[model samples]
Target: MSDPTTDPAFLRDPYPAYAALRSRCPVQQVPTGSGGHSSYLVTGFEEARDALADPRLSKNTAAFFAGKESGRRIHPAVAHTMLATDPPQHTRLRRLVTGSFTTRAVDELRPFIARTTDALLDRWPAGGPVDLVAELAVPLPVIVICELLGVPEPDRAEVRRWSGELFASGAPAVIDAASHSLADYMTGLIADKRSRPGNALLDRLIAARDGDDRLSEEELVSLGVLLLVAGHETTTNFLGNAVLSLLLHPAELQRLRQHPDEIPSALDELLRYDSPVSSATFRFTTEAVTLGGTHIPAGKPVLVAIGAANRDPARWPAPDTLDLDRSPAGHLSFGHGIHRCVGAPLAKAEADIALRKLLTRFPDLRLAVSTEHLVWRRTRLVRGLTALPVLASRT
Candidate 1:
């Protein structure tokens, strides 16, 4: 089979492909985007969920990719973050930074989120066409994350440029370059913060303790890189995907418009309806493991399709339909178990505020372009629109 990662049709809507694969080979090797190395795509909800939490599947990319002729090197700063660590190392790294994502901390940023949303909406061309991807969805989270991390406002555009190039499918050279760009940026930022401290999440992380243990300089820099990259894309895609979903399902939009409070709960449904993340990061099997009655060999690269699992008919009734009231409690959009997204709470908070305000402020918000004319990015990692042109009613 041709590489689906680079396929235009597959990029637009992979759910059908996932369904087809799940029907016959839920756990089977597929061509990777890099044009080298075989990878397993686990599409079954149960299988995906279990594989995500299984300790037998290691997340250590450095160890797994060591000595491989993959043609790309995992940057040291990119490698040491919690997302790429196992057990003790992961636990320690996670403990040092979980405080900022707590409910209270997120709540404290409510005013800022509201301001950011309103400010962006204020710039909407008063009924003129605007690309929501660039005008709002892309920058809001970036700004919030920048402020949160003590990243200078002047440098966000460079940060964004690096992030934008990072998500492209299977370009090892581009990926390596982005990894280094971000790693270096974070390293410089950490050094600057140390010389002159401020009361920001970065400062707190620098000082955070895990029972006499602290994030080493490399871990601190790595965490900064992880948070910056993760913070920018996840919520941006979520917002874009959510708005696109709501626009496509007008009845659901009307339902939410009538009861704005539902928007909060509706987020869960939207997340499941069109998950921002198509698949969780790569996990390699440490030992032979049976999943969905299929035995996967050790030392094999595995990918859990989060988008596929959320839409699995066995778990979600009317799986393809947009039903805001459906229970989305167990959706794997943010993943599962210990490696689950640490920024999820903040992402949800941002989504909650962004959606409510966008809908309320422009009650007649509608897509400026035909649904079919919309272009999806050619990235296998994140399923999002490249440009979402919208018209806001300003009567």
Candidate 2:
């Protein structure tokens, strides 16, 4: 009925609101005012998954935004990225970058990820509180991704700052300005790669472009930004969130520590229980499509509530409770169908190594502050702590 963003009740924990909406009208259209208002906010498990796989719903926001008087212009650089492409193009664009995320490819990086984890932990003070997120989770992914993409070490910190602001929600002007700056930086990065090819993923992409014209120059540039952002941001949140959740549930943490192999399954449960991405990427309707007994008209945006869907009672028995043994294979944490995250294997590997290593290294690790003092990221989409302060015990 009201804008969910500003709703205090929704802010506390939106799952109740989502559950209520889905139960009452699964495909209800909530208004987003311009000339007209309505974007399907799909909340239910089955419906959200179905909508993700549907052909009628397009990811290319530029086309839909063009028809609507929403006053929002999709940046050309953002539009060229695969996230905004509908298939045939989405298919083509994804192919050019899939190799880096293949199971084989990700598996090969396991030892490196473990070493990175150990090294970060080793640097931690012998007996002191530390911000696990900053010292470990944040840098691990950025370093790994920078190495993977041939981003010069000197530019990594600046690029991460630019990328964070670009994805941040709210203040339309802020989003627009950040998007432009990121684009300019990406354009420059691509030029540098072209002039001096390094043995990095960016070089591989450039080589692919030169050899077969499969990816356009603009596409390569945008894809570089996407991979860097996607590769790091989400995993950073996942590691932080997983540690936060596990700490809150000490028994579960103890169980995982006892049987280290279960860390993989426990990671799945962490993903399903409290996903890094609370919602799927926004999608828009191309034509009037009736779903879940409600009709969403043509050219309207929809926010698929992935966190809500993951815990939908109809899909998972005892959904609200986190059960490590319960199979999370079908969860929408990595999304569903064709749009599913391609870098999932890498994300999983990084998280597994980070989480396991942290627990093992600091067997008596405990929170530095009260639970209420833990600050969450300002944006609701990527649910994570701003700081995860942990006291490392020598034992």
Candidate 3:
């Protein structure tokens, strides 16, 4: 039998497979596509929510692989990020950077985001076909994240290249190379910031202090890499996914164009309908525990299927349908618990501005090709279109 998680069909649309698995059991042991190790897959809505916040599940990747023979080589800075650490350390790291991503801070970027959106749209030719993913979706967030991190204009393109390679799942060599390149770049960037401090977020992070506590050199480098890569990657895919969803559902697209005020609230339903992040990062069982009546042994890896849980029938009636008005308050797209995405507010704000501007500027914007021609990226961590070609009347 093929592994549903890695199968090509599953990569295109994992929901049906997830539904099949959820019918049998919410939590089941499955192969990790790694050295004979099996991980517990959590698919049901409630089960996934509980598992995300479960203290018994550990996120310390370094400790988990300390003695285990692993095939891939990961840089120390990449491996020891807050995403891979447990509390006390995680708490400190999160606190040091939390203020930068607050609602107010993201709000301050609204004018800039709008300006960026207009500039990108301005480049589209009159009544021409454009690849939205390349022209708008990719560059908008990349520029925003790069500017926020103090990356000089000349080097932004290289930074994006390294970040893309880092997410090349199953390609260990590429991932390893990208990790080292990005970490080294960030280490140098941090050093430069120290010598010539500016008002960028990276500068604030470098100067951040808490009761005499300060982020270590290693932590700063790791956090910088994490923020730069994660800051834009998820939102880039999100813009592509969200735009595709809207194009496929014309009524929703028209409705949003007719009433732009609803764009902010409608984003949640769009996120839940087709999540950008298919699965949450890996979590390991610290002790044997029963989730959804399945017994998972200690030290086993666990994967929470965010895409599956968001569409679970029990969670929302007509879960497969895209109802813009549906109250999608509890969706796990940004995840739950302490490790939830710190940049959720920023992602939402970017989507709101991007979608509204795109729809309003090009009222006739639409898909340029048939739905069958659209391709999805083949990666376990994220679900996004490789390209989204659309027709728009440039005004």
Candidate 4:
């Protein structure tokens, strides 16, 4: 198969490449532009799940190139985050933030979530031609994350803008600069929060720190920023994708409009049919491990293709078809095993509420432009349309 990374057709729509990978190799070693090459892509459902759960497959990218210095070039601070750690440390880091993400915690904020949704929707112009992304997708998560973190009202826009730049399609220079600026911006916020603690997540995290036992000053700041960026940005893509999907399938939109309770089921199909997270966070191998039918050498980076795995025919009866009623139990959109999304329940709640409300309010919603004319997010890890213009007049 061709390299999906650089292929324009695959970039336009990756399902074909994913399907090809699942059928042809299931697990294939591919080259990366990041100096080092030969990381395994687990395309099959069974193999992806197994690999995700395997303790032997380390999360530490540094371990992938123990001897070769060039291969392990990612920053140290980047490696320290929960996304890049293994066991013991990963457990501790995750524990510190997990309590805040529990169902009860998220449930308590439902009213707030709804309020935010309503507030953004209120801004939508009545009738034709509205950019769903800026009007809805952008504000909902920004407000939610700000409320969660106790980010002050004044700083919210800057934070949101920075986060957008950090995630939006861009050149390497643009991305790197955005990342550094974001980290620095979070550091400043952490300092300010420390001075006058508030009822937000940053304050709570700082208060939660017990002696030298809890997350370090750096970790706390990084975690706060990660939650802000990852927690909000990915969901933005999801909401955008959901809106795009529903716009494409008006029958599905009408179905959701009438039977609101089928939303959870519809979301399942939305997630599987066009998942937000294109690939799992990068994983590195400790020892040379054989996956799918291929042997990967020790010290190489691997990315589990969550998008591909979700559509593997071996797992779903008819992988290409969208079945809203299909059981959502084993979908890997939130991923599987240890590193599954910590804020998944919260994300689901937000999306479900937002989507159902959207369809119910605007039953005649349809894309204002052709799918071919729609520009998609480029360079970002998440797959989403740049803007989804919709006409909502029930004529």
Best by lDDT: 3
RMSD (Å) per prediction:
1.8, 2.0, 1.6, 2.4
**Model 2: per-residue lDDT, tens digit, 117-216?**
8888888988778998889988899988888888888988887887677656566766677677777887898888788878888899888888899988
In model 2, the Cα lDDT at residue 210 comes to 87
Model 1 lDDT tens row, 1-395? 57667677788788898899889967888776455767788998988999999999999987996786765655788755678899889998887778888889899998999999889888888886999999988999999999998999999999998987788776778878988999998888877887898999888887663224476778888888889889879899999999999999999999888899988888899999899999899799999988888888999889899999988998888899989877889999999999998889999999999988888888899999998789987776788989999998864
Q: What does candidate 3's lDDT look like per residue over 1-395, in tens digits?
A: 25553566777677888889888888898876655767889999999999999989999988888887877777888877889999988998998778878999999998999999899999987887899988888889999988898999888889988888877766889989988999999988888888999999898888863225478778888898889988998998999989988888989999999999999999999899999999999899999989999998999999999999999999899998999988999999999999999999999999999988898889999999998788887678888888999999955
By TM-score, rank the candidates, best first: 3, 1, 2, 4
Report the CA-based lDDT of candidate 3 relative to the real structure: 0.88
Using TM-score, give the best candidate's number.
Answer: 3
How do these models rank on lDDT, best leading?
A: 3, 1, 2, 4
Per-residue C-alpha lDDT of model 4 across residues 38-139, encoded as one tens digit per residue: 567888888888888878788875555457655222234434567877888789888878887899999998998988887777777789689988888877
Worst 10 contiguous positions by lDDT, candidate 4? 70-79
Task: Count residue pairs with overlapping backbones in model 2.
Answer: 0
Winner on lDDT (2 vs 3): 3
Minimal lDDT window, size 10, model 3: 1-10
Clashing pairs counted in every model: 0, 0, 0, 1
List ranges where model 3 is wrong by over 4 Å: 1-6, 209-213
Candidate 2 has what TM-score?
0.94
Q: Distance (Å) between predicted and true CA of 347, model 3? A: 0.4
